[model samples]
Target chain A: MEHLLTEDLLCNQLQHSTKQLYRTGMVAQISLAISKPVSQQFACTLRVGEVGVLLAPSGAGKTSLFNAIAGINQASGFLKIGEHDTEQIELATYKRNIAYVTQTPVLFGHLSVGALLDVVSAQQARPFDIKWALEPLKLDTILHMRTLSLSGGQRQRLALLLAMIKGATLLLLDEVLTGQDPSTKLACITVIKTYLKRNQAAALIACHQLEDALALADIAFLQQQRAGIKQWQVMPISNGIHAYQQSLLNDCADTAQDQQTVCASAFLSVLHATTISHDPQLGLCEYRVAGQPCFSAYSPHISAKQSVLLVLRANRVAISKSLLPESSFVNQWQAKIVSIRPVSCQGEHGMLIDVTLVNQGALTTSQQDVVSVWITRLSYNQLHPKIGESWYLISKADAVSLSCLN
Target chain B: MSETDLQAIILTLQLASLTTVCLLLVCVPCAYFLARSRSVVKPFIETIVTLPLVLPPTVMGYYFLVLFSPNDGLGLWLRNVLGIELVFSFSGIWLVSMIYSLPFTFRPLQSAFEQLPKDLHHAAALLGFSPMKQFHLVILPAIKPALFAATTLSFAHTIGEFGAILMIGGNIPGETQVLSLALFDHVESFNSQAAEQLALLMLIFSFVVVFACQWWQTQSSQNGYVVNNHVEGL
Candidate 1:
């Protein structure tokens, strides 16, 4: 009885989610220092409930970063998880709720998956229902098979399930989803997003799917600029790439949205939010924009609390005189007409107009918010959406894509 | 074969068994350390362990004689304190045989351990298996073939030892005259038939030992696990 009570108390103290902590507000910030000389020193912080993506070329120390935190590599630096500093805890007794899933499967070939799963589940302080845990990733069929017999995708999923089974509060993925197919990717991300939402946890995903993966990250660390500051730079993806990715995101609403610090060079679509979640069945993922409820494309497979970028393509957006109830466009937003600049596209005979559309989410900033929507000059002349006048910005669901940055 | 030769063969078996057992307990730890240790002095210790493999048996016998001779400090200490006489005795030959067979047992075990992947150790260590448990669960099972080879080679080497035992035990019949020494005596005398018979016996014993080891090695290389009283490819 005493032993069980002690274990419970330890779990509670180490747990990050509590009613008091939620009320008071807590940050699941992971501040780690990579063991290197001052010349190559790398240390970064990821806030609680935020998913940061580490982007780098092969052998740019991405896995090294994960290895340092997992205590697998030789490292000497401060590693703090939640409220517990690893330096203060006895290594023999300290059981961290952080799980690092590597790209290659680390398995005992002789042991069956079910046997290993039982061991991992028993090790956890509070185990989730095994059936519920295994169903999302389709791990039920593999329970009796030897791990060696599983294929690469099956092994990766099983490894991920094993990690999640331990009730890890912080997940470290080292390119675990680089080469997976679309459905497997969706299933994996769905499981991850749901778990993060349920537990209020954070994750650091190191990925090779650089552009495609950017849609899911709250803050992406590309590379540390060698300038005097030696800081990470937020480089931009191409306009076509961004628009297409956003369209894909809106179709899928594949991630959550949260307030995170990002720098400028290319990635400019960022919104400040406390937390966000997506619904896959309803085909809608929702999050707050400037403390007001906002809705975007409905993604039937998206998990709640996913990062999403609301993207409006300049070509597909139209300026309207009034809210058109009969318009086939699914997304309609009310914004003040800031300016209408005459522009030409591809030397076309028709005149094109760049209409500056602003929303309530853009109102919070003292700096003038700039949101642009394209309209044909003939349509603009007929409707004549005046400057400083309220007008509806209407676009089709296909025109709006959930950008990854926001 | 003569009654004396038969006694000599039995004596050789007993000596080989005793030497192989002692060498295993001593060499296993020595070989394990040599395989795993990263110390700067590891090479020098390894050289010492393998010295018996390269050094002449007579030269080793000369050193052993000087160390355990009755007048020597070690010999005096043994006789006075423990009253264990070693000179020209079965114990004397057994001790000499262990030194002669050290490399035969040590090298295989060292190589077997070195060939194991570092990830195996890393995985087992983080899983909270103690060093003793690691030996029993992981290390021992993986190196069973090497252990068997080492034991068989050590036993055979001790049985065939002639030069070192001659120097240490001085060929006292029924005391230190083993198979090889007894065969050597017949060769030195004019008894060609007896020498031929004893040589043929040693050759047949060696052939059978080598053949059995090879067959087991081949089988182990094939499917690994084998059941006794069973046919293959069933």
Candidate 2:
């Protein structure tokens, strides 16, 4: 909530600049008749250092929007940088200021990483550090490797570097980085976030990762239907970002007090495994969401190839910096803290730490993986966990339970 | 090889070289248009361009002969006004070879142009690559195998020409008599040894061309590039 207010204040501070050059050098305008006419008309004013996220599935008009903004597709729209619309300006010439890293990266096949960087770097009028760009991507050692030979993640990082070196004012990234390790994802996100903040630039990241959307986005442009027509509505995620997760809200309820649904903190999301294996000796049903924390529950009804949503009590889930080896706990998953707030559990001061599961398959039908891990205020202070810091979510296998979903 | 046969082979190489270079210059843009344009005449244009692949060479030659005969109005106008002649000359064979082997070039180039994902073009545009620059940097390299196949096939096809060049640009010594015509003359004259030697050369050239094309396609595909980033399009 505090972050959202600061964001509003930040926007207001940068709003009244016309004559004096502003921090965010240019203001981008997207007014047009799109291919997906009604669906693509999402608008909001963004300042430098402000990041907006477009949360939608693939094939949901995300790339269409990116194409329209980049002036690649034949759409009737005004793409303006600063006061003059780009359409009125030289629209036919390739506009170097717009950096669009598509999901399927199209790189110059023959050029090595160092050569690509050197070429794009020479085109820039402003100063840019190639080492700084390569630092977060961890691509310094692979400078001689050809762009065509790089992996998907490597291509994404290189695209970002080229964008930075070329000085793109409005960075439009289409889920370029995915399937990275927890630390790597954080590093990539930090690189982008810091670049935007320092340059006084704005970005719109199209992502399916909730943590990415929540952690970096000042505003969430969501897909919704109004009067049977699809449109975009800007939902400010400054305060209570988790409440924006649809499943966390009870459809039957209407109040902010009931915003966190009854089942919100109850279920844990397991993305990959189709079947759950039962350990007879421990009497536990084990399922693994690949690259995410594992879950084990004492149940017999859950069978192989079953998609079951395990029930996790708020108190049973524990957060720690390291694995709790002393306790007989087996179910553990790595997650990063999103937000922490004071709450009263059993008439005691407790911290409701919101931890989001980190992975490419972090998406869920319901806000299941992102649940509250209740810890006493003393433990929270002693551990000193902050937002974006990784921590383990653990529960004793014997204490866990599961309910099968049809 | 005799002096006459040597002259014929030299003329054939010159014609094939000129035709291949000119045809590629025309086909690259035509194939690009065929792959991407949505104009109303696109279907008609595509059919006309690809006709040489399926049409009999003699039938195609017959049409060209009728169209470009100096007696015809359009042919006479080009000759008198532009100082250009297209019938019974080296220039005529060059033009005829270009038309007859067009499909050999256009089909592969067109297929390569079509095989590329549209996203790459957009990425090139955002990266500030001009149309020609985009073609050089992105489109050309990506379609190298097809380009190789198209150029070699067109050259080989023009070299082995018979029916079309014979009909439109009749075998005039030193001007239009190509290798294929010399071989025919050798065989018809019952010079079995000369015909055998010429046939062996043509056979070796065709084999090398085919082998090179196959090697290029395999090399391009196995260039250690893996793109797993699948972005769904709307």
Which RMSD values do the candidates have, in order? Answer: 10.7, 13.5
TM match of model 2 to true structure: 0.69
Candidate 1 chain A worst ten-residue window by lDDT: A258-267
Candidate 2: the clashing residue pairs are: A274-A305, A275-A305, A293-A333
lDDT of 2 at A34: 56
Report residue B155 deviation for candidate 1 (angstroms).
Answer: 3.8
- Write model 2 residue lDDT over B114-190, tens digit each, in one string: 77777667666677667777788668877777777888889998999999999888878798899998898889999
List each candidate's DockQ score: 0.11, 0.27
Candidate topping DockQ: 2
Regions of candidate 1 where Cα sits further than 4 Å from its true position: A1-30, A37-52, A73-77, A82-98, A103-170, A179-202, A211-299, A302-406, B1-24, B81-85, B126-136, B172-177, B182-234
Candidate 1: CAPRI quality band? incorrect
DockQ of predicted candidate 1: 0.11
Label model 2 with its docking quality class. acceptable
Mind giving the per-residue lDDT tens digits that candidate 2 earns over A122-200?
A: 5456646647757678889899998878888888888887777756667888885576666777677788887886665
Q: Estimate each model's TM-score.
A: 0.62, 0.69
- Candidate 1 lDDT over B1-234, as tens digits, reads 899999999999999999999988988877887888999998887788789988999998888888888887898788888997777889999988988898888887887777665555544433333466557665676566667777878888888899999998999889999999888999899788999999998898887766665676565444322112111100
